[model samples]
Target: MPETNPQSRTGLAFGGDYNPEQWPEAVWSEDVRLMREAGVTMVSVGIFSWALLEPAPGVYEFGWLDRVLDLLHENGIRVDLGTPTVAPPAWFYREHPEALPVTADGTRHAFGSRGAICHSNTHYRAAAASITTRLATRYADHPALALWHVHNEYGVPVSACYCESCAAHFRRWLADAHGTVEALNEAWGTAFWGQHYTGFDQVDPPRATPTVGNPAQALDYRRFADATMRENFVAERDILHRLAPGVPVTTNFMTALSQCDSVDYWAWGREVDLVTNDHYLMTDGRRTHVNLAMAADLTRSVAGGAPWLLLEHSTSGVNWQPRNPAKAPGQMARNSLSHVARGSEGALFFQWRQSRRGAEKFHSSMLPHAGTDSRVWREVVELGSTIGALAPVAGTRTVADVAVLWDWHSWWAQNLQWRPSEDHDARERADTFYEALYDRHLTVDFAHPEGDLSAYPLVVVPALYLMTEAAADNLRRYVESGGTLLVSYFSGIVDEHDAVHEGP
Candidate 1:
């Protein structure tokens, strides 16, 4: 429901991340030529261009990006211009060292990786905001600018921070959630081990405690971590919304990604103009299609059944995976159409062309380093042709008959120390429930406990470790209204505060 029509496309809306900046300017013309041959429509640009965009504090270089956008537009290719705030320039860390994230053990993460900065860091926020102002205002009227992809996967290298600033932010968020210290004490069950808090500042993140940390406190920290990531997203999204009034904004989501548990997509989905996701075929062979479907269905649910973007997938084997098995013939097309079958209107990959250098050089792309003569490139062109034949799918939405209850809170609470079973995973349990429906050839939507449930004939809830009173009542009402509720093994064991449920 939040999506607007995928703004201004070139062809069949089939393209991926294109980095002409990585190559010589002479090769830029060749890349455009290849795009036209492959029927490429739109491409995401500037995600990792922070250093290139801003070489120093308050110093920006937009001339290079200007030429790239012009070249793409001239060749009938639209752009999903990224805000380039994913990785802060090295100069930012040198200027504001406090922006780096602190680990659970109370050590700051190094500055080499993409997401070294903390979500709650004030300095980082100010700098990122400035970059957004410049980019958004500068390209507001650009014909090539179609969609906005906010920062790449949040909680990528590190999810939460144990810094002083984050701790202060956590206390404020807690104060808002639970008004009084007495209420907080009762909710957190502060009496468990004489860990009562006289004031919110007395609380710290779940560190290496005397033993297993306080379940309630740990749960709140998880909520805080997720909130911090959500804050970063909202910060950038609000700017984009204000500057580019009509352009739909998106941030690629990774549903099965372990590092992504800290980001509550159900909550994050509300903030985005369009829902989008990135999925790579796992170590498993073509069987990875099942996960592809799961990711797509979950993304569809987040979009409220509206069309979402398939932001990034591998054309073949991914370099990061231990076993990088290229997809057999026809599997890539099947994998793409499967997402389309769910709700993705546009089909895309990680990179348009293979990287000639860097970490991802071995990773598959639409145009392989082997050139257009290779199987990878041949399929890329054919896939575009196939997508062009299915233009009607762009307007149609995937219909769901079943709903799967998805909650980040439950996921966090279930993983707390001293649980009934260590093997219990809320997400995997939800996936199993989905797989059963999938096996039966039934379409499903991953519904938030508080989201709309009236559309479903049958609703499946998996291992709901933590449940709110409102959510419980909503599920009850759904059943009373003639909806079939199928619950998994570990359901409704705790309250929202990670306290054991006491039935009346």
Candidate 2:
């Protein structure tokens, strides 16, 4: 197969988020100097610099960013130009109060934290689009610009909103999807609890209720949330493509679902130029390598076996983990190469340098807070050189005799409200199966049950309770074709709407 590597054309993308804007102009030189010592090739710039990029509404400031990008370019470092639209300015909320995302409990979120805006918020989408325009117009032709990292991790915390606007949109989405109230009621199995809806207007969001809210409604809400976030992503991608036509656009995905099925990476993969992921070590040292390998394989599968990027991982312990245990010596480097082995052309971390302030102050970085003297720094330097030696592995494809089928929608709907077992742990179930194959020295590729399964000798799916009609038909055809199939306890037990299948 021809090389599918687009993002890292020059070399392996070995750098992470470079926030020179956080430091003074004086530190830009030092950061770039260290970038060389660490063998950095490409770095994502200004992921959360909205406040700096646009200090006020309708205002643009590129003076400091120009210097930062120039400094990195001078040092032979490529740039993943970030649009800085993740966190809108403080003035955004002040100017448009409706931009604030409302919590499930009916509380409007404040702007201090990242991802406080609802995906369905019109005001926020407009604001994000405006900033993306400004950034693209300014840096479209910059020599250092490589890719566009649109809005930091989507649906991180405030993925859902119970606000009236979102509720109305959700209802309309339901109407468009199911076509009619009768079809929706039947698909949702609303007859179970006298919950048949007469019209779309009668439907409200699956917000907090005095009792267990409808499972089917919640499932639809999850779909709506994913669609909403994807709309925002496409909006940004269109703007970037309009201005900087050739530049590939991407947004990082977490290893696990942070929100309730908010971002369907399998679906999102079709839209982005390349697939990328952010994986933080489990900190408990609990099969971190296996977990990382699974994440890389899944990401590669989403990229259609094309080379993907490790957008963010950790150099050492992350501050968010409870105990925050550091990785053993050489463990961190091994963790990185493991991804490269599984078809990741680029391996990067969260931040280039450890933060001196803010929420992630204790989070590890390429340059530790203790300067270049710490073990993290030494390991970072070593890993950078090691990755440089891995050019032969670049552009190579990863294949396996085994496949693990993952369905994000099924995972979300499996354990909602009530089920046969409260211990319906999909992630853990998938982990157990992966560990068994991993221990036997067998490589595996991840796939959606609905996706093509002709590449593997064995196909295994665990906790796939909610299988769609097309996926069911695909499985039937695969089995008829004589492919070996392995399934765990709760496979193929329900339709897409969390409604159980009738008698076997």
Candidate 3:
């Protein structure tokens, strides 16, 4: 029953996450005025506001959010409304302490930080669903609503929770995946360690164990953990879809290899209505722009070569990094435009205004603490104008000259214990290959291992380590059909179950 195509109303989104709740009502007018001045078109709202939105169980304070959306609408700025499910209210945690995630070593994560929910916990799921339903029912018809931004960058800070609930859920998942304990045992190679299971109830998550856990078990656990979070995402996404029919729903992805290694974006890409990414420059002495290009290309590929949004990037340095040096003058504009060049609908940052207090207070923002007279603010305004001028580029696709094969499952398996070499990093291999192609001025489109590859003339597999037979056959067909294939060392060595392929 909700309105749709909010993106059609605003050509290219040009704003960042707006946390008006952090400021006083008196500052709202100034915020709107500044947004208009900077040519801001859209802002993501209510991402981490669960505590303030719902002060107590079943009680939601929607008046402030209503005013914020109304103000943005009055200024013709669109809203990417968030569900605030990432950080459950402290009261909810206090009530359901079991919802907190437990690590592999049996250490329970405290609730002071964000994204600590045990994805398998029924209470957490119910709470998340309730909040998402309430938001969808309330804001489905809001004038400024453009997109529904689901839970923030999932699989970050916390990915897998090794708790009893998760163990039970993992067993159910294994049962469904393998159909029987016999198949699971055969696939896990439990015979080697005398760890065969007769019943599904006997199995548990690959928690901390002596002499390293089973490689296949660890691999499957990663898949289970990813699927668990995905189940939660699909639940919330379906709620949004049903409540707000025409409106597109998306959760921002940290698609870069180093940012989030647990999530499989290939599977996630099929779920969201629109693909959006939050990319932060590593600034780790490597060419940051190359990494940015890689992230943008990877995100676009996840969108199936369709245009995607650069949902969140820092205006300058981030607080979490070892050396948070500020961006050089004009560097912000360059960084934003590079993404736009690689099929981003528009450029947006982590936040609109620099926070006065919080863990991310020092993270650079569109409106810095130095105010409008500062260089960051000036660059923000200039970038907004630049993006506005490039409105004609919206909905356009970026053509690629080459295809890069990437798989999160392969990365996960390679990262597990007891590999051929600890120095052989999957992400490093990917970056090296991508950087080479980028330097050669060849546009790259990343593809899933088993995805369609006929369109690409040159396909490069940087490092696979784990490859299913279907993917291997797919690559073979591509090569046989006159497509050039370049595979790196240690690729196609093991099957999806971490079992080595029988043939040489």
lDDT top scorer: 3
Comparing 2 with 3 on lDDT, the higher-scoring candidate is 3
**Which residue runs of candidate 1 sit more than 4 Å off their true CA positions?**
1-12, 257-259, 284-286
Off by over 4 Å in 3: 1-9
lDDT (10s digit) by residue, model 1, range 32-145: 899989988889999999899999888889999999988887777888999888889998999899999898888888788777878888999999899998999998888788
| TM-score, prediction 1 | 0.96
Residue pairs clashing, model 1: none
lDDT of 2 by residue, 1-504 (tens): 122223345657799998887787788788888889998988998888998888987787889989888777777788888877778888888888787888788898887878777777788888888889988898888878888999887768666788898999998899899999999998888898789999999999988888888898998898898888889899999999999888889988775432224667889889999788888766455667777777777788888889988989889888876788788899888899888888888689988988888899898889988999998899999999999988777788977879989988888888687687778878778888988999988888889888889878799988798888899899889999998899898888888888778875
Prediction 3 global C-alpha lDDT = 0.92
User: Model 2, 49: alpha-carbon shift in Å?
Assistant: 1.0
Q: Which of the predicted structures, 1 or 2, would earn the higher lDDT when compared with the native? A: 1
